[model samples]
Target: MAVTLTEAAARHVARYLGRRGKGVGVRLGVKTTGCSGLAYKLEYADEAAPEDVVFEEHGVKVLVDPKSLPYLDGTQLDFVREGLNEGFKFHNPREKDRCGCGESFRV
Candidate 1:
């Protein structure tokens, strides 16, 4: 089981890390909230903790906590631009459905 970033997402993360000058990579996890019971959380990580499940792709490290791994396995992150809005999106093969607002997912 693994989580990965798409080519566009990798490039975006690498450039941002370069600008920030400190982050080792991005951290991805799931939180218990939102209508569907789980929401994706992401942040720039300066270092990996001892227990982080790390996946490196295109020089960008994506870290996941063990507890969040089951829900996020086989997920691919992508950076997208739609009209004037741009952001990161997740493609999770395990997701059965998400909330109508797209804020949470159900396994």
Candidate 2:
């Protein structure tokens, strides 16, 4: 089981970390509050929890909690820019479907 970041995603995150100057890495997880039952949650992690599973790629660390690993494994994150819109996108092999609004997913 592993989670990875694309080169673009890693560079995007690394730039943000450099600007913020205090984060150890980025944390990725799931929350149950969207139309498809689960939504991705991401944030800068100043410190990792004891049970966090860490994956490092392109010099950027991605942290996943034990409880969220099953849902996130084999996922590759990418940073994208389409005209004026830009954000992190998830390539999740475990995802069975996503909501129409692109805010949530089901596995």
Q: Could you give the C-alpha RMSD of every candidate to the true structure, in order shown?
A: 0.6, 0.7
Top model number, TM-score: 1
Clashing pairs in 2: none
Which runs of model 1 end up more than 4 angstroms from their true locations?
none
TM-score to true structure, per model: 0.98, 0.97
Local distance difference test, per candidate? 0.96, 0.95
CA lDDT, candidate 2, residue 44: 91
lDDT of 2 by residue, 2-107 (tens): 9999999999999999999889789999999789999999999999899999999999999999999999999999999999999999999999999999999999
Q: Mind giving the per-residue lDDT tens digits that candidate 1 earns over 1-107?
A: 89999999999999999999999999999999999999999999999999999999887999999999999999999999999999999999999989999999999
RMSD of 1: 0.6
- Candidate with maximal lDDT: 1
Judged by lDDT against the true structure, how good is candidate 2?
Answer: 0.95
| Count of backbone collisions within predicted model 1 | 0
